[model samples]
Target: MSVRTIAVKYGVHRGTIPTFVLRSGGKLRSTGLNNERRASAAILYRDGHTLQEVADRLGIDPKTVRNAVVAEGISPRPRGRRPMAI
Candidate 1:
């Protein structure tokens, strides 16, 4: 669960959750896209979807999608428009 979720559930402030977790020897998880989201982003990018397109579809930031794509070992297409065929 996200820090925000834990905070809301326990009626604690979001900022304090991380501190408490660490003090208790609990490791904090990384935020942003998870493994499933990463896989979906990779599939969409591989299918020719642009970073923005994938982000829109997944409700995430384009930069996040780009990072996920790169981490998946897929080469992202060059930015801007694609060339038109005659």
Candidate 2:
């Protein structure tokens, strides 16, 4: 489907469509899906849960969890290990 068709179907401006895929050969990820997942992660994270724990609960990768958190402008705490002090 063309970008214009997708925009009209989704009731969004044609110019608002995304331009990148998650990976070169992978199917293009849905902007709506990303938004929904990000919102879900934010709610869970705000309620006090680690990224790995959230990823497990959401059945997604820790990286995707982190991406969602970042996309929402939330700075999720570092997972696994702490950085060394200088």
User: Best candidate, lDDT-wise?
Assistant: 1
**Cα lDDT for residue 56, model 2?**
95
What tens-digit string does per-residue lDDT give for candidate 2 at 4-54?
788899898876665422244436545323677789997787667777888
Residue 32 in candidate 1, Cα distance off native in Å: 2.7
**Best candidate, TM-score:** 1
* Model 1 C-alpha lDDT per residue in residues 6-58, reported as the tens digit of each score: 89999999999999989999998776688988999999888777889889999
Please list the C-alpha lDDT of all candidates, in the order they appear.
0.87, 0.72
RMSD of 1: 5.5
Question: Model 2 Cα RMSD, Å?
Answer: 11.1
Candidate 2 regions off by >4 Å?
1-33, 80-86
